[model samples]
Target: MKKQSTTAALPGKKTVTAIYIFVLAYTVVQLFWWGILLHQQSKEIAYYEQLELTHRVHLLREPSEFMREMQRHHHEQRMRTLKYIGEGTIFLIIILAGASIVYRAVWKQMRLQQQQQNFMMAVTHELKSPIAIAKLNLETLRKHKLDEEKEKKLLDATIRETNRLDQLCNNILLASQFEHQNSQPFFEPLDLSQALGNALQELRDRIQSHDILADIEPGIGMEADKFMITLMLNNLVENAVKYAPKGTKIEVSLKTEQNDLLMRVCDEGNGIPQEERSKIFMKFYRIGNENTRKSKGSGLGLYLTRKIVEQHGGTIAVRDNLPKGTCFEIKWQDYSLQPV
Candidate 1:
């Protein structure tokens, strides 16, 4: 089915074009008016000069005061014309600059709206797929009598789908909280190693195709919310699983550096381009178009991850892994050890 374009509904292109045309036409008209004013002032000066020359010739004995007064009047007239032109030029430049700013703001808003529309569609599809799959499995279980191993496999699949749904819902809620700047998580000492283990365990069934090489530092702790940290790690791991090819290894580690905790996730996948590194953390800003996207996501994972990291006085950064793939590094600042 052909997907409907969200940007098609926005209605500002024609209006913006008209505004630009009007500004251009107004600028041309102002320039033309200035040219005519200058021509008229020159003509007047020439006419007066010719008259003074004739008067000087006809009345050679006339006083020099008349010529002095004529010169003074011409000087004042020239100054007035110059002042008007200067003020008009400044006004036109200001108007053009203001229009450009407004146009850029409107363009950015339109892009954001389109991205949000895409997000809604992606979320709806993502939610529906897991529910539909789980429902089908349930119906099959109720209708058919399956053997022991087969039944277990079906049950595990159903559980995996359910877990996916739960994760999706949590992402939506966390994204909403971050969007509204209401992410005041209860901070305390959290075991970083345990959090990584739990997060990896949650995705063990889902990541059967890839190998996870974890080298976590033992007894490493930091000031953070455990649940939030788990969610953040889950998101990063899930993202790596989705993007990285099957059979490639994913690396996870945690260590301390100068009173800060450093968490790292490395995946052997097609690395993110340098230009798109900064934008991946914006809400609803996906790398590709939603209509033809191959990956299953609502584009909220990295954004929520960044928000969670920031809430804990931390920073997250992306880098190219040596040889191939992408690396995600997170640093938590002002870390405190758990009490003995």
Candidate 2:
């Protein structure tokens, strides 16, 4: 089966409208320039001819000398009109170029607006559901007499839902922090292996459908914000679990290559199309519409993860996992690492 790429289609209406405007403006400018020149030429010709007629009828001057003078005047006027045409064409081209630039800016702004709308819808749903579930669990506990085990289960469920809400809120806050360019991250030396372990454990509890395989190398420490690094790792693993098929394997590995530390999380899933690989990290950009999406996310995870990694002077990328899935790879050079 052939996989379809998820490249976003251009805004057809906007594109066509831009093109139409360009063509219309160009045409109008050309037509007006030529029309004005032609009208002036016709009036000049009529005046010259009428002046010659008056002179001939009154016998006021030599006809040959008058004819030569009129020819000179017409020649000079033609040259000036030609020069004006050239200048007008150049000016029109500049105006059209400016119009093109404005159109591009407007198009980009419209797309961003659409993404923001989607983000709002997704975030609202994400927040509302967890809060509602926690409230329902609390109400159930208060309204009924239940066994100790059942009561404990309900309370645990409530706690879990509330925790989910907390995580979502944290992600939003972290994303906002990253958006502000001046926000500084506190970094310190930490054990990368331990952080991966903790992130994987948390993800395992959150998503039980996928099995995670960890192949982490010990003694690989780096200077980073441990909390943010853990959050990044958790987001990656959680993303894999969400998209990958049930019971499929999700793999996490950390290793050293020359002067770089490479960390990868891979999964057996319907992989992202090549075209969409770059866009998945954009804020408020999910692969599909929020209302129709089966997967649960606010679309800020990968964006925040990328920002966190970049703050540490690391790079993150996505590639196809061998056989049948996607792989997210992160690499940090030795320069990016610091000892405790």
Candidate 3:
């Protein structure tokens, strides 16, 4: 499917934003202008009252009373001027603060919408490529008589493509379930060592190009949901595969420290930027422009991984994997076996 272009709307959005800013500026200017006019009018009224008082005092020949009335009139004018200035200042502050908040919210929403559009485009391409390859492979097998080796290769390729499609579908479904709070992990007694080893072995089998290494502690048992744990591990490894160069070392380590279970997935790839590390887990968020990015992904892996970890009472963090790479570290606190 051809991806829809959003470039055409860029200028329109910018124009709208410019207009909004212009209106806000104009309003602030008008508010200050009105305040100035009110201040001038107040002074004029005070001057006229003072002149009237003088005229009345002259007619009644009351010099001391005139002086006292003049003082009172001046004080009242000053108080009125201060009151107008104070009220105008308060209103101005409120208007600016409200405008700032609205602008940030609108900007954030627009960014999220753009990311979602990118995700849709990526998913379309991702879904099509695998399905097309698998169909073509099957058709080739049916239409021609091939040697045993050739047949095995085609079947293997078809299986890989089919698995990729299945995983994409699973990620989408699981993400939806977690988003709506409709899914809960069914906790049970799990052997952490065995599960981690199996997941790593499966990943190694699926991705033959990468050198996957594991350092799992033996007999580390924990109470957890096995399926969710496997899914989480797969996501972390898949993410490493997507970024890391072919044949580079991808290390998976699991160990226990002071009643806590720690799992780290380190990749020998270009590390994530410091500023973007925090945003990687947000749904539908990708590091670069989706249209131009060469990597194939639906941007749900990290998000789903984080959700699964959180669901199982664990914390996940990312850091620079020494020299040149990224490492995803996960910790489950106070790990212990529970009755099944």
Please tell me which model should have the higher lDDT, number 1 or number 3: 3
Name the candidate that leads on TM-score.
Answer: 3
Best by lDDT: 3
Tens digits of per-residue lDDT, candidate 1, 111-195, equal 8887888888889989899899999999999999999898898899899888889989999988888778886898886777887
Note each model's CA RMSD in angstroms.
3.2, 5.8, 2.1
| lDDT comparison, 1 vs 2, better candidate | 1
Kindly list the per-residue Cα lDDT of model 3 for residues 1-340, writing each as its tens digit.
2334567658868997999899999999999999999999999999899888877886666677778888999999999999999999999999999999999998888888888888898899899999999999999999999999999999998998888898899899999998889987889878888999998887887899899999988888777899889989988999999899998999999887887889999999999998999899999988888767888899999999999999888999999999989999999988763322
- Model 2: residue 88 alpha-carbon error in angstroms: 2.3
Tens digits of per-residue lDDT for model 2 on 218-337?
777877798888888878988887799899999999988888899999999999998998899999889976656788888899999999898888999999999999999998877444
| Residue 250 local lDDT, model 2 | 96
Model 2: how far is 12 from its true place, Å?
13
lDDT ranking from best candidate downward: 3, 1, 2
After superposing candidate 1, which stretches have Cα over 4 Å from the reference? 1-63, 334-340
